[model samples]
Structures are given as structure tokens and as C-alpha cells.
Target: MEALFERVFVETTVDTDQDGQYDLIAVYIKRPKLDEKVPAVFVANPYMLHCNEDWYDLYDVNTNIQAYPSQNIQREDVTFYQKDPVVCPKKEAEQIVENSPYPEPDPSAYECISDLYGHLLERGYAGVFSGGLGTRGSDGLTMTGSEEEIFAFKSVIDWLNGRARAFRDKTRTVQVLASWCTGSVAMSARSYLGTMCIGVATTGVEGLKTILPEAGISNWYEYYRHNGLTLPAMDWQGDDLDILAKYCFSRALDPNDFASIKPLFEKNQKTLQEGEDRQSGNYNRFWDERNYLQHADRIQASVFVLQGLNDWNVKPDQGIRLYEKLQELGKDRMMLLHQGQHIYTYHLEDSPTLGLIDRWLDYYLKGIDTGIQNESKIYIENNLDQKLWMQEEVWPPKSYKSYRVQGNGNQMIVDDLSQTIYDRKQKNTKAWLDELVLTQNAHSLSFDLETMKEDTRFAGRAKVSFRARIQQPTAILSAMLVEKGKQVRLTPNLDGDENHSFVFKMEEKPSDYFVITRGWMNAQNRLNNYSKEAIDPDTWYTYSFDFVSNDYTIPKGHTLSLILYGMDVDQTQLPFVVTEIEVDTASIVCDCPIE
Candidate 1:
């Protein structure tokens, strides 16, 4: 498709940094020549303009977990911020990208979204891209998923509809306009870029007709912390909201810009550090601002949620939760689930995931009558067998049943989990399974389910509840469901073309055990994420929480093991306290979903 015209400009947004000067957002636009204006596909990402080669700044998680008050305390939860995540920035701008994360993206990063946008151009649609504050060409601090970040993105759509202003360059004297756009916009991207799609849609932004967020986050709290634990999203530890903000602070890459904004940028980083509350790992107003699920009621756009069932980075739960909420709101919504780990669905062969997206956008953006809205609302790559796809009106399917499994052994166990279980660098999961689940640790307890009568499909979080009398004021306890078997687990397509992508490979050595799901809680925060009260020593209290969301089929003859332990070595913050808890086995029953 030959472009009729293309332009790069800057749009102004509120001074989230409180730097007196308004923040400048960098925009790149392209459109196929046509007599009539056309709808546009939009992408707002921080990585486009510039990316830090390295950003290691993180909170000190090795420090002791903070103690709760004798009585419960909940921070004033700020669901909607009155002010943008007031950031800090000083600027000298640059020039940048398009409807994709890159006009020409890294091959690894390039996928169906870019391809789809290019295809749209051939169909007479336009494409536009922009970066928010603190990106290389944009002005303002990068607060990661801050309120300001969301607004900065919304402003671009506003600009396309002529609700806001844009200048041809950094100097505001001359102006430019997206006169070629039809005001209807759709957002399509992956990962962090996908996250921006969800954030802006929550505002019910006028021009946004639809949002296709692939592997995006709905709640920053759930991303960084879970059930009151500072859980890292696979791979690295110590990476928090502050570190993420630091990584996207690309305006500093320019030496002159760095000299001007370093101090203010550091100040913004400090605010993030304090607001994130790394010590407690509890939900607060700061996280509330980045959460989109709570504001789903405000969304007026149709949403196509895409998720990798095996994705550990963003996890399978984030998109599903948003899908569920949209369902409750009775809004237009659809879900596409795959077997891949943190990957684009463009590669899935049998289903042709990207084709569905093309139809979705065509219907939403152009009002095309594709009959897509009448199709099954949920689609998933079956885990029981690779390359097989499944579709139904709802997830967990109508055949879903709960199987209860309980243990009758001793419940009293004590161990100081603050000590390291392995050399810090030794993060091999098979070894962790050996040391923490299969081979018994003095501080952990494992109970087994009867062998499966048939190959049952297990899908959804397991509900675990137990009454425990603890001797400590504060403690961390965990529960996990492991599949005990000698079976090869099919991993999602890694990097490969379509023909080779469908050929599945084993994720790990065929082993005797594989952990299916896990749940952890700060015993004090039994009521919810916000409220926490120190435990009255020796008093019995019931704790209940869902295991991390999961979808898999436990094989026939494979017994499911329910392991209760202290301090998750892989997912929680550490406290150096020698703690003990007496559990009532009768009060413990794990309810797992089955089909």
C-alpha cells in the first residue's frame, strides 16, 4: 500500500510532572491516499521513541517484610485519581514511530498487529502512533501505568478527533491536524503496548471504537503483587513499578535532555518508590490508579481480550479477569486464549487468531457487518492436546465441577522461611520442585488426591481455606496444587514460522511431577488486599484465597498433590521470623475445578 501522505508531529497534554510546561507527546501518522477520510488504527507505547539499554533500579526486597498494626488498617483506596499521577519532566524532543511499536519493528517484536495495521491501510484505513511523557521524543516523567500515562494516550485520540491540538514540531508556533482521520480509532498491540490500550479505553475516550489488548494487564497490583505478596513476574526479582518507570524514562538518553531533567526524573522515581510501598507488598492508592478492571464500567468500546495461557510474564489471569468483568457489565467482549508464553497469537496455526482480530476491527472500526459478534465469545487452544482448538459460550465450560480433596495429617509445622533454599542464582524450577514439593521439607506439608478416574480437564483457580492458630504476629503461608506424573508437557510455539509453529515441543524433561497452580497470603490480610491486622498469638483464624488462575488437564492415574508451606521461595517477600501454625485438617479442603 502506497501512503498518500505521512507526517510526524507533537501533541500537548497536561503537565503531569507539575513542571509548569505542558508535556509534549510525539505522534507519527500514515494513510493511503483516498478522497474520503478514513478510520485509524492507533498505538501508544513508550518503547517506540527510545529505550534504556539497561535499567536495574529496583526496591530492596531482601529487607524484612514490614509488620502489620495490632489492629487492621486500610489505606484510603484511590480508585480514580483527581490529578494525573503528578510526575516530573524537563524536555528537548526527538522524532519517532507508527501504528506498530516500530515503523519497522524488531522481528521478535513485530507480529500480526503491525501486519494488520498495514493491511488496514490497503483497505483505506489510516495508522497513527505516539509515545507518552518521558519517552525519547515525549516530555514528562514515565510513571509506568500512572494516571498521567493513560491521559497522555487518550489525548492522541482527542487530537485525531480535533478535541486537542498538535504542532508540526517542538516549537508550538506552527500547528498540524489529523484532518485525514475519521475520528473512529482502534488500538491493537502486545504486552506493555497492549496495556496502554486497556488503560485508555477505561476513560470511555470518544474516538476509541475498540481495543484489542494482547497479554495486557488490567491491574498493576495483581501484576506486581498478589494476595499481599510482592511476586515478580517470572525471571527477575526486585523489579517493581519504580524499576519499570526507570526503564521507560528514555528522554534522558539524550545528553542535553538528561542534563536538564535528571534531577526531576530522579524525584519522580522517588515518588514512585514511596507510593509503591515495597515494604508491605500491599495494595494502595498508587496501584489503584493503574487498575483498569475497577473502571470497566466507564468503557464504551468493544474489547477483544487476547491472552497466552502459558504466559508467566503477564499471566493468563489478567485478561480473563477483565473479560469476566466486561461480561458482568453486559458489554461487548470476546476472548482468545492460546498455549504460548508471552507471545502474539498471530503464530497460532489452526485458529488463525489474527484473522479473528481483522474481523473484529473491521466490524468495530468500519461498522462492517462481518457477523463476528454472533460467534462464540470464548476461544482457547486446548491443553489436553497441542494444535487442537476449543470454543464455547463461556470458559470453565458448562460441565465444570468441583472436586474436593482434604488431608488428615498433622497440621502443626514451624520453620524459618527467611533463609535461602538454594543459591540465589540457582532458579531451575525442576530443582525447586524436588526440594520444595517432592522431597519433604520440615516446614512444609504435602497431601495427595486419589489418582484421577479419567483424564479430567482442570481449569480455573483452586479455592483453599483452613483455620490455623499461629504463634506469630505476622506470617506468610502458601498452598500449591502439583500434578504428579511422568508425562511430557507441551509448550507453546516459541519463535518459528506458521508451519513449524504448530509442531509442539516439551517444556521440560518428562518428569514425575509438575506444579499446576499456587496461592500465597500474608496471614494478617485475611479479609482482603487492603486491610491487615496483626494476628493475636495462638488464636485460630480462617484464611481463604484462590490459587493463581490456571488452565490444564490432569492426566488419568495422576494424583494431584496439595502442598501447604511457609514462605514461597519463588513468589513472595521474606520475613526472618521463626513462625509456627497449628492447622485443623478437618477445616482444610481444596476445591479444584474439573470437567
Candidate 2:
């Protein structure tokens, strides 16, 4: 076992902080001891290798030692962060300390990724793990999803393919190379690690044969913010790259590594600060660099994307939107959407999804005739029945019916515009449902659509449109699709800080009923995402936005309910604005494809 694995640091060509010195990538390798070259699976992550926490439960800590050969890289360039003692403020420093319970682990220690590493090795495949730019023992400042970070990753492939230079130490004292690599690399990981894989795969780097990204982010903007709205801490939230990079790289328990890398860490703070405009929460050049789908045409590798339809953190839109672009470009791709949250389906109990992934990697990485290419391009799991799976040629049901419901105060007609005034007291505090259920509350409107005569499934993004006018400069538009029947399917659980506790928890709880999908939009972001359009006091404006996408079936005889609220006190911190919505019952519509 000892002979099968080795760890080393590969120097990347990109100058992360533009200090003229190249960044180094710390990597762990495990492969067969046989004399045959093998395709490698590269796991590029910023957490495990970079963070203080040691989650990789490999061997007993007492018995494990640093068996891999390594060299001490000396730092010649110094920066402000290295010289400064208090780089982070008291509040920011406390946040990192409170969340991370584990003490810092030694970077020199060689620990294996218990299940994933060994499983691939047993299958005659080599595996590599490298901390993203500034994480772990790697050199340079960490910028999450930055061009520099992605290029650093590309450098790793360059090294494996004999296109780049690596070293044994900073002195360039000894040169080392990937002598045993076949150069056909596949990247796979979940969440942030998975995002790195997709980010680099967009470069179309040679030798990157395929990628399997699970719950990976294709666009950084969509991951942390919606169309133009910043996501609350409860759903999808993260700090700026500078803070996050420092959180991961600065807490160096290894005194030597910290001393050498501190300057680079401080240099990163300036770049990250200048790079992102966190306050605007709008799409710009900054996010464009982080969006991999924009450069999907450059990808030379096959892609297998995994997403959870119910995931609110890194929502399904991140993967599905990218999948659509790849499909349009005639790229070879496959997708699986399940009824899970932000999780790796392969790790689920007795999951057959794991076998599907194995066959995918085998066909592309090993050049095996697994017949995976002949299989359907999309696999969708039923929310109600985990055992039931449906295979399709494309996502979002190519042929489907559209249902439109218009609701007035008295009745909901199929095509009539309804006029209603929503004017709840601006200063009222209550639960989201309690406010909605109180029909007397002028701010909320609940509509009961016609019951389903037969079972119907809506597959794809839901579009809600209506003509509305608000009294204030800004207002929040929130729509909730509820399935009211004899039983409930989803159980609503509240979690997170006081500001976001109003959101329904998507996981763990069980019930017969559940909200299908909810859509939220700020009144100002209606016309242009970057600029705000003022309302003409009482004049109505037609507004439409997509709710999160979903593929769910409504049981027969169930009445579909549409609940609209002018403002959610729980989600927004600003003062409430009363909203007046005018609709010829038919003018208001909740359009969804019936699959």
C-alpha cells in the first residue's frame, strides 16, 4: 500500500500574484505498482488539502507518518500579509474560528481520500489530489474560480502531459516530472472541487479526456445570486474570495509553510477586492470569467453532469443551463437530475448511480466499449419514487402541454385577467404562511387553481407573469406553488440565521405535501439586471420571471394553489412596501409544461 502512493508539489507556470514567481501545486498520487501507464483522475479541491479540518479518515493518526518524499520550497518574494500580524479583523477572524472546529493538520502528512482514492486504484486507475492555488502547502494566493486559479489547474495537466516544468524545491535545485502518466486525465469531485474541474475543463486543455462534476457550479453568479438578487445566507451564500482564501490559506499550523506563503496571501487580498463587485449583485465581467458555459465551445472533453433538482444551495439551474449549452454545441454530454439536495448521489445508500458513473469514466478514460455513449443523454428520477427512473434524449421534455391559470378574488378562470389590491400594513410580523393564509391581510393573495382531473407532471422552468404596481421604489415579488390534497409531500423545516430563518428547509423533513418551486424578484431588476427602473406610482407594469426549475407530478384530484406575496419580511431587511397588482383574471398566468 505504501509503495502504491506518492505525494509531490508541481510548480505551475502562472504567476498567481504577478510576483514573477510561478505558483506551486501540492499533489498526491496513487496508482498501480505495475509497469503500465494509466489514465489519471485529478481531484482539485480548495478545502481538504487547504483547510485546517482533516476529514479524510485514512489511517490511525498515531501510526500514519509522512512517507512521501518532499522538498522545502523557500520563498524569496515577501508581501504585506506576511509581515502583518493581524491580517483579518476581529469579527472576520471569529467567523472562521467558530465554524472550523478541527485544529490545523500538518501539510507534510500524506493522507489518502479513504474511499474514492482506493476505489480508483483498485480499478487500475491513477488518482491525483491537488489543493487549489493557495490551499494546503501550495504556493500563490487563492482566488476562487479566477482565471489564475483555473490556469494553475491547467498547469497540472501540462506537467502530466510533459508540456510544463516542475521542481523538487524553490531553488530549482532538482527537476521532477510525471514519468508514469499516460496523460489522459479525467476530473471528478463534488461541490467546490467539482466546480474547479468544470472551470478548467472549459479551457480545452490537451490530455483532459473527460469530466464528471457532481453538484458543480457552472456559473459563479448563479451559485451565489439569482438573476439579479443576492441569495440569502440560508440558500446559497459565501464570502468574497479574499476572505475565503485567507480562511483557508492563512491558518497554517505549519509555521514554515505560513512564513513562506504569507506574502502571496496578502497580495491576493488586493486582487480579489478589485476583482469582484459584491454590492451590485449583478452580472458583469467579473462573473463572466467565472462562467465556464460561455466557453463551452473550447471544451475537448466529454462531460457527465450530476445535479439535484431539489438543491437550493447550488441549484439545478447551474448544471442544467450549462448542459443545455453543451448540447447545443454538439458536445458529448449526459445529465442526471434526482430528488436530492446538494449531495453526491454516488454516496447514497445502495445507489445504482455509482455504477452508472463507473461506466461513464471507463468509456472515456480507459477507451473501453462500455456502451455508455449509446445510452440516453438524460436520466431523471421521480421525486415520489426513488426506484423509478426515466431516460430521455434531451432534458425538459421536448413535447409537453402548457397550463395557464388566472385568478380573481372570486374565482380562478382559465383565461380571465383578475384585478386585486394588496395593501397589508407595512409593519407586521408573522410567519410566511400565516401572513398568506390571512385573506384579510392586504399584502398577500392566495389562488386555488382548478383541481387536476388526471395526474400531471410539470417538467422544466416555471414562468410567472403579471401586471403589477407598487407604492414604493422597491418591492419583493415572491410566488409559491403549493399542492393541496389529502396528504402533503414536503415537510417545511426552518433553519439558518434570524435574517433567513423564514425559508423552508428543503431536506430531512418528510410530509405528503410540498411547495413545487418558488420564484422571487426585486421590482427594480425587472427591466435591466444592472439598473433599476422606477415605477410611475400607480401605473401597472407587466413583469415575468422564472421560478426555479423542477420535474414533479401532481397526483390526480389535487388542487394546485398559487400563493403570491407582495413582500417577505423574513427574506428582506428593507422596510415593506405595499403592492397593488392588476390582472384581468386571464392576464395573470403561471405557465408550466405538462410532461
- Tell me the tens digit of each residue's lDDT in model 2 across 106-189: 644423232565667778788777776766667767777877778888888887898875654445445566777888999987
Root-mean-square deviation of every model: 4.1, 13.0
Least well predicted 10-residue stretch by lDDT in candidate 2? 91-100
Total backbone collisions, model 1: 2
Candidate that scores best on TM-score:
1
Count of backbone clashes, every candidate in sequence: 2, 19
- Residues 221-307 of candidate 1 have per-residue lDDT tens digits of 988988777887866567898887888787877888878888888898899989888777778888888888999999999999999
lDDT of each: 0.76, 0.64
Per-candidate TM-scores read 0.90, 0.79
lDDT of 1 at 34: 70
The list of candidate 1 runs beyond 4 A from truth reads: 4-7, 74-81, 84-116, 398-406, 416-421, 493-503, 507-509
The residue ranges of model 2 lying beyond 4 angstroms of the native Cα positions read 1-3, 50-114, 232-243, 250-267, 270-275, 347-350, 398-403, 409-441, 488-512, 566-586
